[model samples]
Target: MQQITGREAAVAVLNDPRFVVPPVPPGASGIAWLRATVGRFSSGPAHDRRRALAVAVLDAVPPATLRTGGGHPVTVLARALGIAEPVMDLVRDVAQAYQPGTGDESRADAAVDRLVTILGGRHDEPTAALIGVLTQACDATATLIERARHRPVDEVLHADPPVRATRRQAQVATTVGRVTVQAGEVVLVGLAGGPAFGAGPRRCPGWDHALALVAGALARDSPSVHEGTPDTAPGTGRD
Candidate 1:
């Protein structure tokens, strides 16, 4: 068997439109890459985790803007993952409170309290660990914004030249306006000069790359039990 890196899996998602519209161009090793990335696991718990984490990362946005009040992306993703509504809410609340410019550290505590209350004492360690992971994701978003502070608008959305485009794949990366990477976290800088944070359907240039990035990152970050490590199953555990 060939070794598959998280990045290559991400690239596959970018190139596959059945996964998203206007798929990124299929690369030279498209078939091999696709098989290595998507064929690793049959549909199972692991697959679900991979999907859920993919949604979370690809759909990331500011909490307030992400529509978390009952019927929003958070709820949708939570449902997809089979997690209780309350748990998803708690995660959203905590993330919202901790975000900068939202003001007030007290809110974060409230969010944390709600989470603890929902999970109860026995789940403290697990809750803490989960919270830490979510917090890291939230922080990653912040870091990306900060890094793009000085770059030109066009430069931000620009992809590297010589992208992998296949005859079957739709145009990808050609219409991109900007791109941003903070540490290892990547965010699309839209043509409008706004961070394509949770862009609504019409606004997002296309999420193939973004979704792939999120899926790959979540798969990499998650433990085998949570969302399967990148080199392993890429399962869809509670992540």
Candidate 2:
């Protein structure tokens, strides 16, 4: 694996055609299927379409609303998505298992099944897209909230990013910085050194919504409400 730093190099690696996200296996069900189907793990045109769908979901939930809304981030987000009942626990479970090697997948799959039923009966693209939104917002937003306690959120993001790195695979032999990375190698891009959100096609679309959630939490709840929480890396979908 190669480690990439600095904003310019990060941008180059992110936009380079020879590098792509390491794709999850297809032909899966539940969380595995959601992992394979979402834009976060895909590249190229599939990513474009899926990301657009995700953006459309975010589009429906204005950041301003989230900034002033009441409730846990997951609950607020779920309600914003038009879910009436409480699904915070379910969303958190799915988010915990959304990334590879994270949690009990059976529980997460069952959570995904419930979420699917809540959104709409069919497990299709739009439903998958909404799940993608909730999963991405989970730990990442919480980590941001914790880190922003003293410093401004902008500084917390650049100087001390909650998710410090993002992984990209080299599809072909490529030179990143002074190092020549071979095909099938993984390069860890240091988000601490890069442009905000991200710098290329996979840039986060729900940034405003994320920031708004963080701000709203800061305004609504005391930090003690989150005391003694287990340390977790932000969800793996930083970009």
Candidate 3:
């Protein structure tokens, strides 16, 4: 495995075509299966299709709505999909599942099952894509909200990013920042000082939605309540 920490080097590796997002191994179960279906884990044509779907779905909901106290973005999205479950509940479940080595497996599985049922049980592309949006946006936005009360949001994101790191696999031999990476080698990109929403074909599709959610939440909450408080946001358990 190769680790890239320098911001410029990390961006170069992330933007290069020779390095690809590592694929989830086959036969993943439970929360893993849901994660595998997300666009971030896909490649080539499948990635393009899922990414378009994600963009279209997210785009349908204006950022202004989030900023104007319209509702939680997840709730809006769930209503758009005709799902009746409480949006924050679902977000909490998915967020817990996404955390590594934390959360109740059985509870997470049940949440996935409930979401799958609500989306008509096939776990099709659209359902998976929407879940991906919620999973990616929910906790991270909440974290940003919690942290921003005491510091600038950008600083919070830089010091404790939503995604601390990402791994890529070299599809072909390539040199990244004077380092030769062999085909099939793994590269871990440290994202603390890297691009905020990633820097390549696999950049997160929910950047706007997340920012809107954070902005809306901040706009609605009193700064006095959150100031100098440690993050006690929901779904922020150890991952």
Candidate 4:
């Protein structure tokens, strides 16, 4: 694995057509399957379609809806998608699964199953898109809330990004900056020190809403109230 840390180098690698998001190996299932199915892990037209669906779903919710002090952004987004149950538990499990090698396979699968059911058991593209939204936002929003307690949210996001890094596989022999990368080699784009959200094509789509949510949470006299609380807290209703 080659780690690309320079901002320009990382951006080049991420945007170049000669590189693609790698796929889960054959026979991988459970959380790995969920990861692979999401737009974040795909390339080509599939990525385009899924990404558009996710952006549409996120865009449909007004920024004020996320900042109304009603519920965690994850819950608010879930409710907007028509899921009636409290979804923080499922969000937590999926968030853990997003971290490399941190989630139990069976547990993550169960979480995905429950989340799919909450999204109406349709198992269609829209359902998967909504799942992508929750998984992508859950941990990042939580981290932002915790870190904002000690420093400015922008500084916290720059110093310790929710996504520490992202990986891409070379599709053809290519050069990123001065480095020549061989086909099939993995290139790690370091995000912690690069940019706040990310760079290039794969930059986070939920960045605006995430910032709004964090700002709203911090505006509260008790920001920690949103940190790890159960979804059952009073006044945690939909926006």
**How many steric clashes does model 1 contain?**
14
Model 2: residue 198 alpha-carbon error in angstroms: 1.5
C-alpha RMSD in Å of predicted model 1 compared with the true structure:
16.8
Candidate closer to the true structure by lDDT (higher is better), 1 or 3: 3
What is the C-alpha local distance difference test score of each model?
A: 0.31, 0.79, 0.67, 0.68
Candidate order by decreasing TM-score: 2, 4, 3, 1
Each candidate's TM vs. the true structure?
A: 0.28, 0.92, 0.80, 0.85
Q: Output the worst ten-in-a-row residue range by lDDT, candidate 2.
A: 222-231
Clashing pairs in 4: none
**lDDT minimum window of 10 residues, candidate 4:** 230-239
Per-residue lDDT of 1-239 in model 2, one digit per residue for the tens?
57888888878887787878888888456888888888888888898899999999999998988877676677778888888878878877887777677788998899988988888777888888988898777777777788787788989888877676778899888787787889898878777754557767788898889899988988886543234334455336455
Candidate 4 C-alpha lDDT tens digits along 1-239: 67777777866766677877776542234466566666777788878888888899888877676776546667766766666789878877776655346556677878887777767776566776788788776766766677787898777767766556677789888878777789898777666555656666767888888887777777773535345532321111001
- lDDT by residue (20-103, candidate 1, tens digit) is 321222212212122112211213353344344434544444322222222322343334334463454455445543322233
Per-residue lDDT of 1-239 in model 3, one digit per residue for the tens? 56777789878887787877767644244577766776767778887888888887788777666666445556655665456767557666766656434566666777776777776777677877877777666555666667676787788767776566677789998888878889999777776674767777777777776777777777777343223223323222111
The deviation in Å at residue 208 for candidate 3 is 1.5
Of candidate 1, the 10-residue stretch with the lowest lDDT total is 228-237
Which candidate leads the pack in lDDT? 2
